[model samples]
Target: MATTASTAAVTSLASVTLEVADLPSARRFYRAFGVDTYVGLRASEAPSTGFRGFTLALTVSRPSIVDGFLGAAVDAGATVLKPAAKSFWGYSGVVQAPDGTIWKIATSEKKDTGPDTREIDEVVLLVGVEDVKATKEFYVGRGLTVAKSFGGKYAEFAAGQSSPVKLALYKRRALAKDLGVPVDGTGSHRVVLGGTAEAFTDPDGFAWQPAA
Candidate 1:
């Protein structure tokens, strides 16, 4: 949601393909979120449950804009997982989209000084994996560089030479807790990431197909 708006133009994520049951409904929901672009939609009824092992983040510029995007999601039939609130890091809110993707709208800026704008600074796709260091190594072997990291707690990869949507890794339980969801998931991740050097599955079974 939030336009799939991404400033995460640094590794892969050439295309964020979401496999949804209802294309028309999904399209409308995303459109109402003010996003007419990004994220490919395919028809699928894959049985996925619980947390889905990942979350999409819309990083905006201010708290007000964060509120705007979060509100848009609520209006679009998304369930609020966490209400918008200021925190030590910044301000943010979490919502599970109608299609079951957990999205976080946030900003490093804790306060609003001017009128809100629908500008997303970064669209981060955080994968909740079982192991951060190992997965980080897996991605590095696949030609991604580390953008930022903190021991084994978390790690982010540089955006591909020509792509949007930065990729990051975090402990699965930690991510689920952060998103206010349970720490168990089964079946397809319901997502096929584009823009990989080659098609392969990760250590955690997340699929990566070549970007077309």
Candidate 2:
């Protein structure tokens, strides 16, 4: 079974969507500012929306849109990831920030009520530690409360107010076994947990802790 994170217990995600004109140029600009980009597809619902004039549509439009959407955010200095790119799917590219906000730039492809309903349900945490209790204590110290407990095997932490990220703790070995892969806790891998919060593991051992 796949482990899950509890967003309801954690902070809630603040989200927005924007339409963009260009993908590659926007991506390049962000890169110059030192923001990493993650290439993604245009929403299948785009074509139905009758949107044109751009190869992709960012959830948050780049250039003026981003500046306006982020407002004080840019002034506060947010890290730029990827600028943008044209995806293989014919739609343009988009990127996300450390925040759950998604920046899309491209033409709408198709229209639908929403994407597939089978999206990830929760973010699962694979903790590498000799003692589960100690790790649990570490997060609890981080102001997260225990929402559900699975013996000593796993625990899902409740998010605090305004926190959109959900936290889960699992024995590293157990998680690997469940995924049908060799357990290597020493290295790092991106764990894209499900639910409203978008989570990932970046390079370095540092976890991409998402804000709720």
Candidate 3:
């Protein structure tokens, strides 16, 4: 199990690969959001269905920025699951990626008291797992350090000072409720996380592929 003192071996989120039926369309949609996404065309399998048990969160510094991002995503053909609105946490919106992945674009109202950059400053890949504690231990055992943790609720891993993206784990049911989705998500995740120590699938079936 990973302790608080575990060293962080993962540095950055190298890439997030999405398996798409129509690769070109998926590319166009994500590229509009400034994500240099790597698309892998499905050779034989049918397209995935329903939620994939995770959501990629793009965090900015202001409320207006959330509207801009959500608008851009809608313009680029993303399906808006939740419209941009001010919530207790901040302003946020949800969109389903063209490749079937869900994304939550948000900004903290408490933190965005200064000038607004209106630009995405950080990316947090939130993986919904059946057990937050056990999953946190799994990553810790693999040499990732816990930056913050709330017992059985959520846990965040330190992705180094210079890393643009960080990794986080959350309880599946809680995450599903927050996203207004079902707890038992069906079909493929359609997402791949690259730049990890080993290639393994988490309890909820999110794949962490090795860095190329």
Candidate 4:
């Protein structure tokens, strides 16, 4: 739990809206990964270009599961950016969803000492912002408690031990460098985050749709 004071207005991550060129294609692709994506906006309204400001991460409980997910993604027509491999933190891999959204599947070996659940244990929506400090403060002010922070470089919020999803903020330039991409991205982000708030746009232009 967060030791710092919190309003606790926001409870959990309900969903994420991705702007894709082909809604049906994107839906099919994500559904293949076990996501029940809600297609709210129309195809004509979606931007021609895809958003690249964020990456969705799926954390599992074991290395074998990570490999399984990577294989499934490949079979689902997802382009593999990185094959499943062992890392200092764990075994992981990266794949680009058909709609251009990057999905990283990983499992921390240190945290994988337990039994294999063979399932996605957690979903992390990692937002890349131009100014990490400002973004961190913005979310913190909105009743979110910071679970861990490292100066302005990165921060993670604790939704709860049982919460299926978690939120994280990262430096845009740093994240771009890590992903081997350019720092600047254009077009409507077409991503919507749902919370307790009615409807608002963050400092970085990410939209938040209030949960019904």
Best by lDDT: 1
Per-residue C-alpha lDDT of model 2 across residues 47-161, encoded as one tens digit per residue: 2121111111223212333333233324433333333233344333333332222333332332233432222222223343344576566445433578887777877666444
Please write out the lDDT profile of model 3 over residues 1-212, one tens digit for every residue.
23334443444455566677777676677778655543333422454666677888888888777777787888888888888778788788898766677788888873445554557788888888889999888777666789999999999988755445678998878887787777765677777777655566655677777756
lDDT of 4 at 157: 84
Q: Mind giving the per-residue lDDT tens digits that candidate 4 earns over 67-168?
A: 777777788888877778787888888888776777788888734455544478878888899888888877777767898899989998877444456789
TM-score of 1: 0.92
Q: Could you arrange the candidates by lDDT from highest to lowest?
A: 1, 3, 4, 2
TM-score to true structure, per model: 0.92, 0.35, 0.83, 0.82
Supply the global lDDT for candidate 2: 0.36
Which structure is stronger by TM-score: 1 or 3? 1
Any idea what lDDT model 3 has? 0.73
List candidate 1 segments past 4 Å from native: 1-11
- lDDT of all predictions: 0.83, 0.36, 0.73, 0.72
Candidate no. 3 TM-score: 0.83
Query: 1 or 4: which has the higher TM-score?
Result: 1
Model 4 pairs whose backbones collide: none
Across residues 40-121, which tens digit of lDDT does each residue of candidate 1 receive? 7889999998879999888988998988888888999989999999899999999988999889998888879876788878
* Residue 155 of model 4, lDDT score: 92
Q: What is the C-alpha RMSD, rounded to one decimal, of candidate 2?
A: 16.2
